[model samples]
Target: MQDLEIIASAGASFRPGDIPPPPDGGIEAWTQVAMGWIVIFATWGYVNSFGSFQAHYTSTLPQSPFQISWIGSIQVWFTFFGSAFSGRLLDAGFWIPTFLVGAGLQLIGIFMMSLSTSYWHLMITQGVVTGIGGGIIFAPSLALVATYFEKRRGIAIGLVTTGNSLGGTVYPLVVRALLPSIGMPWTARVLGFINLAGFILVAIFMRPRLPPRQTGPIIDWSAFRDTLYVSYVGGLFFFVWSVYYTFYYLASFGQQEVGMSFADSSLITTIINAVGLPTRVLIPVLADRIGPLNTIAPAALCVAIVAYTWVAVHDVAGVYIFSIFYGIASGAFQSLMPTGVASITTRLDTIGSKSHWGSYLGCAVEYTLRGAIGARESFEGWLEGKD
Candidate 1:
């Protein structure tokens, strides 16, 4: 009865073509941006830090690096793929319940991950559980923030995404400091607490600005008909595939190929993420001026070029140099992706569904390819070692 009443009240206030324009700059609107930052920090930030986990798991577990990466892979898979359902829920005004469930699952997954003793246990707790939690909230939060700003969407998104790079930076540093002294379980517990605090802040302040957009297909089939939309989605799929593979393997490459110590290699992950902070903030300012697609095209090319430069980098100094350049380019591309999607989208109500669905497909496919190729390489290495 109360739910129906609430819906009736909302309908009374909002008419089909009478929706007000986004405030673009105000206390309430900006507050949503701040809370969106926290959401990204907790979700993607945690996911981006998987390099730290990948390195540690490889050394301790009986599984190969290929096997250990599935933990991160599966986590990422769920986070992206699950967005298809969660995005539609956001469109329907289920934000509170969705946010609560996502927060609960995240806390549960991380804390349970601390206690996990085997590969399968970690896979279930960290990969599947945490991934689902992050996926459920991540897209909706971004879309909510985007709805609050029209002119400044690029910078707004860029600001929120800095949490991704920063989270990646902080978690690795925490692991480096605590892992040797306290062990993996305690380190994970501390990280879980950090996420708990961030989620609390988000739940208190963040809200959907527009009234519930209750009617729409979950999968906007019409989006597939637009050539530009199809092309944009296809481009992002390949970009994300390459980017995530680098995130997962860069530290391991430093250790295995460059003969760096564990401590030094972990620092490589830190450097890659840390250097991205400035670019994440600065590039979106440009995106807002020239347009997100204009900003993204060059940034993607720069990342691709810098990625290839890794072939020439064989020393400690060279690796650090590569990390800096790659981080800058990649950060620019990532921070602008959603804003780019928003730029192309015409309807405010469908932004959540369209923006998430395309990128989510990319993310899911990236993990699949990573697992398959990594498994093959790992098998060949094992055979050679046996001989």
Candidate 2:
């Protein structure tokens, strides 16, 4: 009992030297990074392409923008919030089962989403079910990167995160073509198959190196008392809150305000993710060299400026320029948030715990503001910046 109390008390304050050495670079380690990349490609990629769906729903359905946004909102909420549950599972050494179930659920969710016709059906399957699976896959995919590449952790994480950018870039374009010709049901089914391919690789290659320490409480509330941890969490919450606003609404803004074709509007999203692909890789290399916080802090400031600047653009050229800057900046933010959390954590083993805390709370920040009551105001996006 006393030993347990001592561990609980020690919590996130433990020393870093206690951490086991990572493989740094070997065939197994690189394979894990590749697997993590595919994992995010299957999950976050879908989330990144939500704007394409949002535009279609707003134009086709009788549902109000407020109602439609909720679908995306719920999915986003669970994608991050569900991590609170799955991260603990990973920490307890249930890697194989947790990952398999997550991949399976994602397969089911996407297939179910294809059959959805009503608002509630889409919300339940695509928004809730898929998001939960995303959380399950996400926690372990991220944690393994930290485990395998102690010295190049940032670079490894950045590589995996680029999958989000790649999926975002590819999916919007793919769906845009399919939705116009093949239609929604087929479009979703095609995406499900893509996810299946990634899942196979994940089952084959993804792994964790160390056993769960189980060294302390599932959550170390005591870590909240640390000024650095607290400050980092606060900043991350606000930064995350500010992101995706651009991604979700940019397609609508292009078509509605600038009078672009649906194809052109969707292309705007493709541009952002395309620009992000290189940025995701390059910025994390910088993060490793200069430290994640120094890299993250400046990147956050750049994104905020880009977010508010959306109001001034009234032309395709201006929007294109905006996409270039926002993609690079936002990519840095997405890649760095988990990396940043991992940085201030006192012990390597506790990194997953710290990440879930920040991500769960950050989802709350976005969800509360994006709720139905203030829905239109929020989705107008950029706050006096769009719509």
Local distance difference test, each candidate: 0.82, 0.78
User: Which candidate has the top score in lDDT?
Assistant: 1
TM-score of each: 0.91, 0.91
| Residue-level lDDT tens digits of model 1 in 57-101 | 878888877778888888888998767678777778989999999
**Candidate 1 ranges with C-alpha deviation above 4 Å:** 1-16, 376-387
Clashes of 2: 0
TM-score of the candidate numbered 2? 0.91
The C-alpha RMSD in Å for every predicted model, in order, reads 7.1, 5.1
